[model samples]
Target: MTTPNNTEHANIAVITGASSGLGEQFYETIAHRYPDLDEIWLIARRKERLEALAERYPNIRARVRALAFDLSAASSYDELSSMLAEEQPVVRVLINNAGFEREGLLRDMAPKDILAMIELNVMGMTMVNRVFLPYMRAGSFEVITGSVSSFAPIPWQTVYSASKAYTRFLARALHEEERKRGVNVLLMSPGNMNTEMNVQGTSTGKLGHLPYLDLKRETARTLMMAERGHATYTPMLFYKLYRLFAKLMPSALAVKVTSIENGDTHGR
Candidate 1:
């Protein structure tokens, strides 16, 4: 609740969606990997969850700041900007990981859900990057959590895929832009993982059968790739091959193939 002293030039890591899943994993990875960090900022909508996560690292060297902000709301960005101005901390790493997906046909999805996807996955992530990037000095790393769905137009997960495509392009472009400034921007396009966001259910259809990556290992690998100056990290050989296939195949055919592969035969 209390801000760190303004006079202290704390080296910090900022992680959005740090309440659970991959975001939580990123916190753990950063804690171990960057022991010199003076603070770790955990941003999410759930205050209690963020606090709980912070409590887990009580014995760690860095101070944990649990910032509960709903990134979908414009006010959250304003608040974060104010706090950053006050703290003026040196951002060692920034992870824009707050996003959600609602699986279904476009028409079947609620209007609010579609907008929410764009709000958080696209707008929220973009704003977080903008607000934090200035505080990140040379050698600081920024990671945008993309998805394998970004490779092509997926039928069932239409909005989620489209949003990730936005993230993919933005992150890659930023990588080039920031590289000149000696900052690294990494796009981590992970496939399905056993996280709360990817809970197994009947609606998952064929996606539930796909191989899931270990959250810890993949998170670690992503950080390693970023540290090595890689612009993007797509885990698992299967998804890697799929990315190639999506690139080589025609757009129309790829959409049709993905539709059928996911058991969506309504149009046919």
Candidate 2:
């Protein structure tokens, strides 16, 4: 249970979905700061893109490995475990950043899509945590990406909201469970961001036009802050206000307001 000193406790950081968006920013940030990082394993469905990112850092290029696999697949966890044991990399930090969204009315969304969301956001994250935690060193840690939406029930983005809620709760629970074991867990609840996940021309569009959408650099900075041991951190100020307002509002009213604001079913 020793404090994590950034300068002295540098170790490998494994980031899932590192091909683009916030995950890509994290990969770049860590690679720049911890040049001697034991290894940085990037997992995503796009191996080619991951390779391009790794090539940018020739020093750590040899240490960076890309594993392309659909995390939503049924046997993904077991397969990942085998790969890790074979590599035997000492993973000191884990970033669960792989996520996606299917925008449409829930009724119009395919049942299979909903199932995939649950499998990737919940089951996949849990599986990775279970496999890598035992291998982490004494001063190791994990960061799970939740969302501001996790704080309230948002319409239209139903599955995405619920998935992040699961992540937020799971991260808090795991932090308590792993403290005695010398492991730290952090939950990163970010507001809207300019990423592929938030489709262009959509209502949840990156806050570039509004006052929110945390930039990739800033979000990565906040995330690293949390990884260094803040239990819970939100990326932007307005998001904090939104969270407070949501908490104080009645459940029914809050949902209705969110639906109208986001142009969901209730608004119609």
- Best model number under lDDT: 1
Candidates in order: C-alpha RMSD to true structure: 4.2, 5.3
TM-score of each: 0.92, 0.85
lDDT tens digits, residues 73-125, model 1? 99987888888888789888999899888767888788988999999999998
lDDT of 2 by residue, 98-188 (tens): 8766545788888977887788888887777787776676577788887887887777768877888898889999898888777888888
Q: lDDT of all the models against the reference? A: 0.84, 0.72
Candidate 1 error regions (>4 Å)? 1-8, 200-204, 260-268
Best by TM-score: 1
CA shift of 76, model 1, Å: 0.8
